[model samples]
Target chain A: MSFFNALLEHTFLQHALFGGLLASLACGVIGSFVVVRRIGYMAGGIAHAILGGMGIAYFLGQQPMSGALISALIAAVIISRVSRVSKHGHHQEDTIISALWAVGMSIGIIFIAKTPGYNVDLMSYLFGNVLMISANDLLLIGLLDGGVLLFTLIYFKQLLALCYDPEFAGLRGIRIEWLNTLLLCMVAITVVILIQIVGLILVIAMLTLPAATARLHATTMLGMMILATALGMMITSGGLLISYNYDLPTGATTALSSGILYLVAALIPQRRHAVK
Target chain B: MPALITLKDVSFSYDDRPILDHVNLTINEHDFLGIVGPNGGGKSTLLKLILGLLTPSTGEISVFGKHPNQVRTRLGYVPQFATFDSAFPITVLDTVLQGRLGKTRSLLGYNKHDHAIAQRAMAETDVESLQKRAMTALSGGQRQRVLIARALACEPEILLLDEPTANIDPHHGESIYELLHRLHERITMILISHDVGFVSRSVTRVACLNRTLVCHATSPVDSDSINHLYSNPVSVIHHDTRLSLEDNL
Candidate 1:
């Protein structure tokens, strides 16, 4: 009990709480779209693809987040554009995304090998070190959260149309293509923010799982968003406490906990009907 | 009256294979035009072309004296039943509200008026009872009604439907036709179907297609004309064992 009290009193722990809350909010909102569009795999692909940016930034002796953002954005743009023209459609998008993921990890591995005296803490980036989060990182997260919330509010109608029926949306002048691009951009931004805490390997789990879990219980889009946000907050905060007590990795714990929650939700019995 | 929609020398091909060939069509206001054809005769493709979902390869298409895309907001489309995934998490009311997206501003969320319009549309389609229910939980007939409600929420000048009653029960199918008949007085409609009798009875005009348009005009159509339009030998099968037995004897 004393140890828990000490941990709570720590400033680093406070920063972690604040950052996790912000990150969770961003993921929960943006994740609703990702799950509805069935782009969970694409999100995973983009998250992993950020490693290439991390490698280049490390080689240049700069902040890895900068490189991760730039590289992830570039990968996102390429994936979105290529997915549009590819003969196999979304399958081709997944193929390219997986290839980018492999390339990114390989580049990061090589850069780590070349760098002399690996003094920088790489694990902090991988599993998240919320204690080390600065004011600038917090501000960046706040801005991203605000942007995502605003975008969701502004384009609520159009996004709903795009999600439900693209064909009808096109006929009704919803600008399906532009909305698709905008959604992909939002996913990229969300992934970049999450990579700070969950790392590339596990960030998609945070994005996809909570919304999916919420979907099992909620009948409406708004309900799903609310449930997802609530679930995400629980996972982040609970995982933080567990990590502090057991000295486990926060990202892995949070992701695993969320995944379990999804399974539990799925097993709960209320109504089962074939999808229309 | 000048045609409300016109397609002049319109053609569409996917890869090297042509789906619609040099199709010419004109639809006037308040006209309920039913397009019928074989399984792969491009009935759905033609609707897509008119709705601006697919661009024409060779010619000009106009809706209300403007290009289809330019006037897209004036048109409503209810696509084939297979196009939507019901597993998507959304309520019936929310799905219907999507029809108002074209009229709503991009940044502003749906207002009270939008909600009211969506509710009215659902009521018109007889789906208001299922407003709060999950879409996937509805029956096939109910789902179709919700989709119609969504299309109607757009308040369009023209409504385009691709196989609106394709998978529903006969009762539901009749109800759909009845609904369309009632709505025909207000909005122009283009219905695509494979059932000849259904279209011929309900539509003001009938269009028969086979890889290309064979005929399109006001209906109460003749059987011979439809036979010639389809280019298939019309056969009547009488299930009689007596005829065969007598022939053998």
Candidate 2:
């Protein structure tokens, strides 16, 4: 009840609640693809790699989100290119992602340390503070959400085929390598949007949890996406209310909410749909 | 009859190791060719080369008088069952609908024509009844039929199946072969398999690959030659008398 009253009284609280909804849009859509393709680790690596971009932007007195967007796109391209060129396969790709993951963190730490003045927002950036999201951040999140949704609508079939059986897609005249790279680019953008809501640390959790939970019940890909979005909304709003009432960190609370739901869904014994 | 596909002196190597060496073969229109070989004998490599998924290091190949890549849409492919993700959240209808991907151009989604074609393909493959079922819920035999339906939805001139029955029991495997036989009248087929007996019994022609290829009619294939080709004892069963061949390895 107090949380509802605070939502009515505070503009920042409204923005946080609105921001969670917008972030959930991209998370439900792109996150479904990430989970189905089993690329959550790659998304996590992309998420962590954004710190380098944010730190550089802060050091240069520029908006950190812009730097994040640039670095995420660059990291996605580099990772996909390495994956395409490596003859040895996914092991090499995994190694490259780990390297970028650590390197990005170290680079960010050095840049932030060198920046002048007390950088109090560092923890907020690392862990995220949805309450601190400004009007401009809300607008940015909306635009990115639109971009993610549009891309998905336009390339739905191609993306579906790519995820299901890439070799077959290639035979059918889909340029799978380019399509795969474009998908990674989408993942990169999605990571940046999620970063604004959950920060780098919990971005993958937000990206994967709702979609994974939805997978248990969805019968189709589109069904999965829609159900995941609804699930995301529930999880995000539930987390926001809990955090507001208890005075806890909003992002971590939201991620925690999603994780608990996913575990609960998994524990329920589903009738074996698969044949032996 | 003119050849539907022609390969002249094709050789493919991976990282300086040869997989296929100087293989020349011709596939006529309506030919049901079964490819048999030991594991790592380049049988699958030959199929990949023909499908334009891999390039031959030194050879010239042509499909319908053009390059394989140029005519990819006209060739339907059913990959190995082991290669698929059955747990994916897709229905049988949607899986078959992917076969019409080449013809589906609208951004709105698959058109009415696409759905009709997919439906017909499903009916032909006997998976129309299971169109709404989740892919994960289907048995291995059912999944294989769905994959074949997906390929058939392409309305392809030639169908390529890579070990479609590799994971199924002999009962299901025979049923899959029967399904393929029924479709043979309208579409050319190239099948890869380890069951020498079935290949000899089913296909119009058999190609034995052991880093190279030996083309033979079904009637003259003997166990001694096949066992020597595999460098071990191999069982050769005869299921019919229509196709008969025997030779020295």
Candidate 3:
């Protein structure tokens, strides 16, 4: 059945679409900061590290997504601490991020290996099956989305200062280190929401690609976020239709579409100055 | 002039490598002080210390009769223009308004008074016309001016600049110095510069740093003293005329 026809008939399709919308809210908001601050690599590392959480959760016979959430938040805290310590030292931040990334995936694989049953569902977590998004997953995504939006709204100015120039923010008595850690934690939560739709491997794409595309034309952070969110919704819907039509993987199709859209946006000649 | 900032035997090091050693300096109110030094001579590090961005390994530094961090909001800082990411999406007005961050009390964002202050700062720096423009659309000189405006929006008692004219052309550099000179009438200013000639010509006081510091009144500064501090033959320009240290001596 065509995606449009199935969308009318199937509750799962509706849940998947709603999940995409909720995920995009967090993606557009947090992803804007992540892209502007140039922390996408760190965010990517956090996403990859989530597999370790899933692995441990499965080993403990718990919900894998819950494990992913716990793992993401812990990874964020650890990454922020590592970044702070290594910022002025010989030990580079990216080196540590890469270590965590690899270790997390490796641990996940090991745990899945030890699980008694044939853990065929592990594939869905790695490369997400959006069509499998249950109503419970939608509720979780919604709650996370609300938290991300509220936090971003309250601390928008401080976050802007931090992302633009952290030293200046520190001088302003902004408590930049604590704010940075909180920002990372927010990114971690956003990562979990994104993992539901795009899975761990392709999560960074959904997190960054729309924001990157919006950056080409946005004059302000708020504009970039709003534009990125709208673009994200369109991309998700488009990817879903195309995947259903061609019987392709939904997560990969969404990631591929996001990449193509970003490239296309880059190629288009944009106005040099955004409207005031 | 009353002493506004005082550093007592301040020593700082990075990983046991001494960047600054036993440096003592006092800055007075309404003073335009310039700090000039060789590369890696801890000039920038000193400003960071004063801004409370870095703690000293030893010694006491105080601003406004208190710790630097306690008086941080009262002190403005203009970072090197080269260090900025121009491609970052922000408006000139928004960038300047960041100066009011420390004073902003509400979570709803900048207030009417904040906007008024930012606008006044942009006007003082002659960047009011460019307030609506994207930061990326600005030239190097325009960007420097915008940064100055941002610092000025803080309504600071003392403004600290780290190489305000490092990357801009000579013409823009001169204008920036001119703006700083004008601002000196009301605001105490401390700036680090590599251009010894401009420092000597513009500032009321000059401090030459090279693992140690030598303070000199502007009129009494000479190339021989600077060359001795640098431990290298350096050329010092005065009023567009290039003079080798030996010739000036």
Candidate 4:
């Protein structure tokens, strides 16, 4: 009954709640594109690959978040290049990503091993600590949310054209390769930010589950994003509350909320698609 | 005046496999050119070249007397009907509205004028009523019409379609060609098709492509020319006649 009181009472809890909302907005907007583009596997690969960056950061006594972000970006580019830029093995994106995914994770483990005074808590990175969100982290999340919102706003139509009909978009003078690289970079940022909510292991689920559920009900990309955001907010905040009250993992609870909602959405046969 | 699109001694190859070998062609303003060839005879490849999707391995190609890249916005293209994924959640109107991306370059995307153009294009393609329909919910014929509506949304001077009639029922095929026939009076069109008999009646001129290309006024595309163009010494099945050009490969 005093849950609202506790939220007001605890600053960390307040930060966690606010952090949940920011994650929801970014994930909801970014997740729709990831699911629709069929790049969920790539997102997963990048998420795991971020471990390499975090390890390198620890070894160098640098900001682990920056390392993770840069590594994720590099992994995104390599995957895009292998799948697109390479002349012969264009279709072997999954193969290249799979190789990188393992290589990245192993490199991180080795780096962490080699570091003399490596006392960084791997558990927090492996399975996110939403409750441990700092003021700086919250600020960074807010900035990322702004950037993502601005990008979607400016490129909504072009992105729609690119996603729905790439060839036609290319014919219309849209630089397909450059735009693709930019989109992947945006996705990399999304992965970096979302790690706090769902950790590396569950980040893909965090990214896709709400968007997939929203896709069941919404017909337009805009509608999909809005509904997915609302769903993500409900799931993330709800999961945070449940986890706090019942002493469970915040990431699992948040992701489980989305998975449960998706099941329910799937069960309800989608309404007939009315023309817009 | 320069032709709307001109390919001067253009040749394209994949590895050692030749697609279009030393082909020269010209398309004038408001010309309806239907390109017909065997399955692997570079019919679609020619459209790709014109659309600037592919570069010639040898020689030069120009659209509107400039490089294809410079004239892309003025050219509307419909790739093969086989390439569309109907499972997408986009609406017919939204799909058609994509054609206006070239023009609607503002913070507030697709103003009233853009919407009006899309509506007119949909009307032109006879998909006005179905604009609100989900793209996946539409029939094959309806989807082709929507695609044409999208291409028309560009208000293009030259329209190129890879294969609009493939995988469509004959009744729908005829209707699609009829619609194209109506549109080509204002827009120069190049349609690629392997079925010579079905598409020959619609185009004013026909281009026969193997590794080499041959142009014939629509009335005189006899089996002698067909035998000469195709590798097999065989006959062609037209709108009436049933014959097979035996495969040499």
Candidate 5:
């Protein structure tokens, strides 16, 4: 009762709650695909790579979020393009992804270094500061959530086909490359939206773990999404509660809570249809 | 009936290493073709070419009088069953519904009509009862049948199956072929396999693909052609029966 009272007393706290739920919504829907496609590393690469975009945005005197979003989309295209070019070229794709991962961080570091009078909010970028989440962040999260929901509602089947059987989807004349590019872009967008809650470093964990934990119990993709969203909300809100009461960092505490929840879920024996 | 698929001097190479070399072939309506070749003999590669997963390096291919990709919706595909991720979180029904990918335009969603086709396909494959089961929980044979159901859901004109039983047990493999034989009359099927005896028995035509094509053009493919396909004539011991498998020289 008092927790709700305290949460309602502050607008920033309310924004954090709203933003966290929206982030959960996006993560649950998109993260399900990310887990099934086994694109965790690539998604992580994109999340980290978005920092380069953020850094560049900072250097270029542009709004950092839009710049980050654009660079992440571009990075998504680059990742896909690189993978496509090397599909049969005897090149290991993991190496390419790793290269991009390093390149993104390196570029971000170099740009941050060159940005004169740069305020060091690297902590927020790396770990996150959900307590400081603003109304603008909430609106951005809401809009992104809308787009993601609309996309899933309209193209759920297409996304399912793409993830389950790419070749079959291709043979169905689905224009797999474009759909794939769109999927990667969504991953990038989801990362952009989530950076405030879990930061770039821990983004993949929240994106993947909730879905992965849900997958053990879910018989269908929709079921997985629903369960994951609920779990994400619980973890996020619970993390927020702990942070508020214990004077901890909101995002890290929330992320740590999710990690603990995953362990607990894992420890729970006899989860129906659990993967071996 | 017009040619359903045509490949003209098609060749594919992986980084300068040839997989298919100067291959030319044509398949017509209602043709049940069994493409048999050794490992790395371009049998799967040929199917990929037709599926438009890879463009031929030096030749042209067409499906239903159009570019392979353009007519992909009319052609059903069953990729190697082993490639499926068992832990993927998809229901059998959801997997089958994916076959309706071509029918549902954006915003239209899957109408009841689409579900009807998927249900019929599931019934045809005798997997209707398992519709709600997760994909990973099914047995190998059940999974393969579900895959066929998915392919059939598209109502495709030509069905291409790539090694449907490569990882299946011998008993289950025959049953899988039996299912294919049942659907043979309706859909023109092209099956890629290394099982000469099975191909010889099941298909209307047997094409030997080893960097080139020499089709038997008849059922019950003769031992002579089998011997030619495999330069070194050999036989297999299958369930106490002597099954011949000739290796390409």
Candidate 6:
């Protein structure tokens, strides 16, 4: 109880909590679509692809998230369009995504190496530091989360149609191409907001795992979204508490917690006989 | 009567290989058209073109005197069961509700009327009991019924189905056809099936495709005519065993 009280009193911890909640909500909602669409690899590719923008921002002496956001948005568009046109199969799509991921990571590494007196705390960027979250970051996260939630709610029918049956959706007057592009952009924005808490390495897991777990239990799309958000919050808050007490990397711990939750859900006895 | 849908000298190809060539067709309102063909004969592609899911390489196609996409609100489609991954986490009700997506005003969300329509569609298809069930849990026939309900929820003037009865038991398949038979009174239907006898019985007309349009005519078609239309020599016994056009009709 004392530790809980102490943790709550810290201003940075407060920001971290708020940030985590907002980010997790975004991840949980959009992540459902990502998992259903089988775009897990694309989400990872977009996350790593943002590294190029981070490198560019560092070179330009600007905030990294802005660069990350722009680069990620561009990469998301390019990757989605490429994946759509390639037509070979899932294997080819995975190869292209992997190539883009490698190139983006290399760009960030090279730029970071060239900078002088660049002895920054890289661990904070990689593993997340709850103690370093700022008010501005929290505000940005809140607004972006609101935007994503609004867009998702407004376009829920269209998105559901696209996710379930793209060809039929097109037949029903849904603009599948535009909807696909919009979804990719939404994912890019999600990755940008998430980078401050989970970082690039773990953001994909944060986005996908909670949704996948929730799907095992949910009967409706809306139910899946709510359950996934709840699961994400649990992982984020519980992981933060564990990291604080044990002095471990916050992002890795949070992601691992979500992974464990997924495994547990998978193990739960399902009503197999009910299935027709 | 003026045709509700017309295709004028349509041709299509994928990567320089001709799939549909110089074809023309017409469908009247309330007509039930069955498209039959061998594998890779572009039967599905023809349906796609009609639905505006694919663009014709040459010629023009129109639905109700407008482009297919422009009149999409009046169109409902049920694709092949194999085209969908039933493992998706969605309820029967929600899946059915998606048929009304185009009618809803953007950003306003679904209204009471939409739910009512979806419910009515489910009731009509006899899948109302499965409304709350996870789509993955349903049998193939049940899933197909839910899909049909989803398409019907659109209140379309035309309903398109691709091999809707492929994987279901014969009883369920016949029941599905019975349901569609009732539905044909108010809406135009285009169905694709390889089961020649079944389609010949259920449909008002039959269009045979073999890399191109072979023949299309009103049913009670002669079995001998259809047998000769197939390019590869198939034993008459095979056709007779699988399909009995006279008995089915």
In terms of DockQ, the best-performing candidate is 2
Location of the lowest summed lDDT over 10 successive residues in candidate 5 chain A: A267-276
Best by lDDT: 3
Interface RMSD of 5: 2.5
Question: Alpha carbon lDDT of residue A194, candidate 4?
Answer: 92
- What fraction of the reference structure's interface contacts does model 2 contain? 0.69
Model 3 CA lDDT for position B84: 61
Q: Compute each candidate's TM-score over C-alphas.
A: 0.91, 0.96, 0.95, 0.92, 0.91, 0.92
lDDT digits (tens) for residues A1-276 of candidate 2: 688898999999999889999988999999999999999998988988899998999899998999999999999998888888775443587889999999998888889989999875788888888888899999999999999899999889989999999888888888998988999999999899888788899998999999999999887999999999999999989999998889888889999999999999989877644333
Task: List candidate 2 stretches off by more than 4 Å.
Answer: A88-91, A273-276, B238-249
What are the chain A TM-scores for all the models, listed individually?
A: 0.91, 0.96, 0.97, 0.95, 0.95, 0.95
lDDT of 6 at A83: 74
Write model 4 residue lDDT over B152-222, tens digit each, in one string: 99989988888898888988998898899898778888988876776667788889998788998653467
lDDT of 5 by residue, A133-156 (tens): 888888888998899888888778
Assign candidate 6 its CAPRI class.
medium
- Judge candidate 6 against the unseen true structure and give its global Cα lDDT, from 0 to 1: 0.84
The better-scoring model by DockQ among 2 and 3 is: 2
Model 6 TM-score on a 0 to 1 scale = 0.92
- After superposition, candidate 3 runs with Cα above 4 Å error: A88-90, A273-276, B240-249
lDDT of 3 by residue, A1-276 (tens): 767889999998898888888898999999999999989999999999999999999988999989999999999999999999997877789899999999999999999889887675778988898999999999999999999999999999999999998888888889998999999999999999999898989999999999999999998999999999999999888888898889899999999999999999999978874322
* Residue B82, candidate 4: alpha-carbon lDDT: 67
**Candidate 6: segments with Cα more than 4 A from true spot:** A87-92, A272-274, B235-249
Q: Cα deviation of B191 in candidate 2 (Å)? A: 0.9
Ten-residue region with minimum lDDT total, candidate 2 chain A: A267-276
Name the Cα RMSD for model 6: 2.8
Q: Pick the candidate with the highest TM-score.
A: 2
Note the Cα lDDT for every prediction shown.
Answer: 0.81, 0.89, 0.90, 0.85, 0.85, 0.84
lDDT of 2 by residue, B115-188 (tens): 99999999998999999998888889999999999999999999999998888988999999899999999899
lDDT score for residue A36 of model 1 = 89
For candidate 1, what is the lDDT?
0.81
* Top-down lDDT ranking: 3, 2, 5, 4, 6, 1
